[model samples]
Target: MTPTERPAGIVVVLAFAGITASLMQTLVVPLLGDLPRLLDTSASNATWVVTATLLAGSVATTVIGRLGDLYGKRRMLLVCSVPLVAGSVVCALAGSLVTMIVGRALQGIGMGIVPLGISALRDLLPPERLGSAIALISSSLGIGGALGLPLAAVVAENSSWRALFWGAAVLSAVVALLVWLLVPPTSPGAVGKFDFVGAGILGVGLICLLLAVSKGADWGWTSGTTLGLGAAAVVVLPAWGCWELRTRYPLVDMRVTARPQVLVTNIASIALGLSMYAQALILPQLLQLPGSTGHGLDQSMLEMGLWMAPAGIVMMLLSPVGARLSDARGPKVTLVVGSLVLALGYGSSVVLLGSPWTVMLVSAVCAMGVGLAYGAMPALIMAGVPETDTAAANSFNTLMRSIGTSVSAAMVGVVLSQMTVERGGVLVPSEGAFRTGMLIGCGLALVAAAVAAAIPVRSARRTSDHGVAAAERSAASVS
Candidate 1:
């Protein structure tokens, strides 16, 4: 569509919601240093500020995505902004780390905006603009993250870290108002009994799983508490899967997920999550470690934030390109290329992480891979499920990435724990452990690529059974 004719206002509102939701997490990265001292907690514990947000976001995304489908997409979008606002307020006033963690958890509710936004696009936007809009909103995950880090750093340097959350809170409220004003209201998308049982099982399972990941290294993964939780997870998760298969309105359709393509893509998404987390979690440590640590880059928070800033733009730039490619050749091809590029990125990091420029370059490469794989995911999901199932299916895809990142955090933590300093007293990554993690990530991305390739792409465009009826009405009206 021509620029003058485009529905820029509506799309921008969606984008705003997407950006604010994701920004909540990244904006906190630069604040990790001050949080421990400010809250009188250990640095390790302060990390929960990030972990809590991620965990809450992961669960909320699934639940809200389904509700958005069952209720109205636009209605859910409006409701999502409520938590974003509330979370920001809590974080702004949080005196201790515990309160901040709670606040962050609340902020996670905003993660719903993107997937639900995709659902909304199917209803609100014309077809010609749909693909590009999807690409942009999806890539907002990366873009918001990238932008949030630098913007937070700048704000924290000049003022207080608390102000950052306040700012986010304000931004979320503004977005909420804009959405209410600009986006059209519509009827609900699906009618079914909400899967209370499935939600409970999955929520408990993930909380256990994430708690294990986030705290295992601190608590000793082999401790009774850890082992007991692990054992319960093994039992509970399978039981949940069985329960889902039997239920009519399952929280997750484990049956459909049993498909090779879906299963493999999820597996790949997890790996990519792990690989992506390494950079997000690890590199910042590497960059800011004191010069006393032989290999430390010794960069200030702002400098490091600036250095990492360009990666977000690269991701934004590649998203549509990947989507276009997916449309022409297939999403599978785009996903495959993304995974390989991601592997190449980690490999590049092994060689070039020491230099600022090199680190940025490798980051851009990884961003490109993320753009490809992430961009392709929705298409894969929408193609596989009936129209009524769109929100739930996409929610699962989103969940996989969350699980993947959490798992990666655990794996990376283990690797870093086993690490030793070089002869020069620089923190030297265990070459074996580091390479092992990267190679695993690369392998996972490869698996995702293969899975994407194997998924039988429909020869023709997907014709939605229910939503299509509305589209037909609109078309006839225009004629």
Candidate 2:
């Protein structure tokens, strides 16, 4: 590929890869109720099907990103796809809960593709085109989550559940082929010794932290197991941080990460993730709960998914607009706009709870905010870090969002569990409880807006200079 050649094929391929990776997050949501029966396992065991993926994805994303920085983004991308393809096939043939958990863990490894794809945009796309390309790719995270639910619900309702896995397998294979053909090879990565020690330390800490967050409700938050893991993380993570600072070629460069611009953007990312996921958690249930409950929409799973699917489309449509905004007003301004929109969406939910259409409208508004925020986040991080640290920094930012979502799930679970109404001998979250969750989401979004407002304007100029330098290096390598 020449410097003058456009990267249309590259952007599409990378975006498709991102969508493929994110689809794994929601692929099994439709199967949750049926999982115990399908695998002949207890409900607690079935939950691991979800938890395992979360843990694996959290760890794999960080680890694979550092590896991509050391090896090559395109190479690691292909490496990541192998697991996705194999995991989907294994899942298609899975006969037990254990097999399903293993396969899901493998699928989680593929989540690295999203950040790798974003970092690759920094490498291959021109400075002028980079903003929109990055926005579209980043927005795919929300797009896949939004679309996957309805798509999965339809497949599960109409066919053997196994067909879902088979379809994912085919898609993963296709993505691998497309990436190989469309994505051009870049220069060799930073030559440094692989930090196995740092990787192990970080992996253990994240696994412990995430497991406790995702399962603390089921396991009893203060139980010995949860407490022990929590305690271990508190100790392990700080130690991991100390080590990163001391090491010569750390997996993540703590100095760059600690910069005011980078640190503040990451902090805002967590809040944004919490705000975005809270709506996702609450709306579907409100739409699907028994209408007899008076507060519920009395819709089926497929109906709920269909209602929610439009939000994904709205994110995709709004992403390019966000890119233009970033170009005109700077990413920090775009991020603030996104955060305020997100808060407005949540505030609207307080009134929109009466009907399905209103709920969808609120969801679409939130998606629009999410599309803008997600697009700007990577641009901010890329601006603050050197080109060599691009993948690692983006991956860390991605991890912060996952952490926020995990915390949201735990906090929302606590609220819904505490404030429940009896319905047909089963307890469900009350209308007030859902409203409270939305309020919390609104508050988080406002916090994000405040944090984004604080990022220095000087960071944008710094990033532009770095981008030009990086592009020059890329062109020289290609020649």
Candidate 3:
């Protein structure tokens, strides 16, 4: 059947693909404590399971998005599924740390599916149906993450940890088959020589920067390795930018990316990403900590995840509402409102840490903001860029969010590690530290709101209308 004939099938298939890819983000969370024992490795070495995925995903998201714009997005979508399935299988059979990290890195390479799926919506769906479909796919990242934790916790507690990877393998294989059978092929969005040099340079720079951000706390923030990687990122990223600007066929169109609308939206995205993650880090710790700390809820991992799972459901349910808000008031206003809601969620955490119910309430509110913001970001980005650049622009925006989350993890780690209370001779994070983390999230959310509010409203509307008209023309020609 033609893409237009089955748009709903395409959306559901792609959204499922996105959710399957994002599940990698939290799949290993439940096993983090047992990884060293399971793999017979040191604690630090075991961490590479998580860090490898982050580094791989960060690099692969942009590169794959660019590839999708050059080749058929459907082709790239299938290609992405290969590694996701393979990685899950590898991880399932992994008996050592090296094998597990290798599998995780492969899984991360598939992270581009979310952006690719979002871009595909623009290609396949009518403009009227675009907003809500994009909203659902974009928010799938949070949906998968919030839901994966509880499911993983349950499996890890009852069965072999390998069962988690085996399940992932099956889910990924199903997503791949669905995409192949259900999602129609789209025309390549751009024609250009693939920028191998830019991809490599950007990969190197990102690896350096993310490695430092994610590992700094464990590696000693002042250590030579951390400092050196940080220095390399500082130098390498600028060089990569210069190369991109000079290249005839750039991996990322720096000129388009420098537009006021796109730039401001990206800036706001970073802050929103940071704010979104800060709560994810702090609240689970608060929930799992012993109640003796005066602020802890003393919940099991499964219980904590169950409490948080509602937030994911809330995000899923709110997608269409956010779409209506964007349709009525513009994506800029939606973004601003979402950021404010996020700030409100964090701010309320200051006074609501007394019980799991209050904590769940805070999480649901924050998820609502994230749902609105995530839904609007792509609309804002796609509005600013030509249709040809949709996937690349969205991928870059996704990268910005990744950077924000990395920074948040590092910053929150420092705060929680330093301000610890002695609980049975163990240095657990104190109540004050959790509060401070929430305040930090709150402040960043406000910053996001302010930045989003500054997006050039008139220019964005003009560009968006022009983009839509051009896309319609292109589709007519294709048909």
Candidate 4:
């Protein structure tokens, strides 16, 4: 089967499902205090509501993405929503932390949907509208995260936390209905066997890697468990890469990925992810710290979420504009602008930590920069590869972003641990530790810029559709 233009209803359905799925992670945060009592768990245990979703999301995305490439994206889209619905229902009725964690994991199936939906845009929208359409899909990740907190806060304050999950369930159901009615059926990519062996290794490897990253600080970074998991990941990922090269139909094509453009994009994606999350991890700490520190806002989660909401809105609103610019001017320009803005934003964060409003203003500017880079990346990947691998490639890109965020989170953890302020005085971080991470983000952004600038715009310009003759030749050279 081939794709035809989808009905407008279908497009809305896909986008809505994608967005609600994203809400699953952040929405749980507002209920942070309530969770411990409701679920009979410790405050620390309650954090798993967010972590479970993230862990499932990080692994399920790439695997499902590959499956989409091998099977059909539309089919996977329908199947994926089952978790969103089931997970929400489970959480709504859960009486224990263990059960809720399971539910959260199920809800994570939604994370993979965004990448799939973005790739699906090419199938639904006309060429003229494609840029903006992709922009909305890509930016949904941040938008859902931003919107989830405040919305959940309002719901939790007015009623119950269960309502949040229930709402997500209801929203997901609507998306499922829309997708069934809207998205056109299509064949899977690359005619061959599924890469079960490769998927197994990569999936397990990533889970161990993320478990280690998310819990490293709590578990003791040097603990036998953490060190063992780290070693396993080190051994497993490279082995998986090698196996992908040898396999006929790999879950991921290391060979294609090794291409200069793809490899460079992945590098930038990690940097972008880290830079994007800096405020996410840092600002909350700054805002919630004791006000006596002079730099702290001593805000509650609701206040912090509200303050940060504008940055997310900026990312959402600017994504389309950035996408159009990527199409017209090129992705390189968008990426460069995004990173520069990000560095500038952090610079503001360092200087104006006392004035929370200035941080919000600067963060929004950084988000605009992120919108540009995030929007341009998928377009760049799509332009370089055949349509067959679009969803999988997009998922892989999302994976890299997750990795970057995890890396940043873990590294930032180490930094915060080392830089505790004295019992009483102006709050001061280990200036060197914090700046090291920020500088790394800035450097990677510049590298992404360099990669984008080299896209051979004048010479490598392509028609909307081209013969698949070239990608097959490159792909066939796998061994």
Candidate 2: list runs displaced more than 4 Å. 459-479
Candidate 1 residue-wise lDDT, 345-462, digit = tens? 8777668766667777877888888878787776666655555656776777888888888887888878777876564644466445555665566666666566556665433443
Q: Could you list the CA RMSD of all candidates, in the order they appear?
A: 4.4, 2.8, 2.5, 3.5
Better of 3 and 4 by lDDT: 3
lDDT of 4 by residue, 1-479 (tens): 23444445555666676778888878787777788999988987887887898889988898888778778888889889999999999999999999999999999867899888877776555665666666677777878887777788778888877888888889889878878877887567656787889888998899889988988888899999999999999999989989999888888777667667667777778778876776677766666666765446778777877888887789888976776666655665666677777767766655555566876786677677777777777766665556667788889999999988888787877877787666365445544545554555556556555655554422233212221123223433442
Please report the TM-score between candidate 1 and the true structure. Answer: 0.90
| Per-residue lDDT of candidate 3, residues 139-243 (tens digit) | 999999999999999999999999999999999999999998998889998988999999999999999999999999888999999999999999999999999
Query: Model-by-model lDDT, in order?
Result: 0.75, 0.89, 0.90, 0.74
Clashes of 1: 1
- Give the runs in model 3 whose Cα sits over 4 Å from its true position: 458-479
Residue pairs of candidate 2 with colliding backbone atoms: none
- Candidate 4: Cα lDDT at 271: 71
Number of the top lDDT candidate: 3
Q: Give the per-residue lDDT digits (tens) of candidate 2, residues 1-479.
A: 76327588889999999999999999999999999999999988899999988999999888888888888899999999999999999999999999999999999989999999999887787787888888999999899999999999999999999999999999999999998888887654566877888999999999889988999999999999999999999999999999999999898889878878789999999989887899999999999988999899998999999999999999999989988888777788889999999999999987898999999999999999999999989988877777778889999999999999999999988988999999899999999999999999999999999999998644334233234344334433432
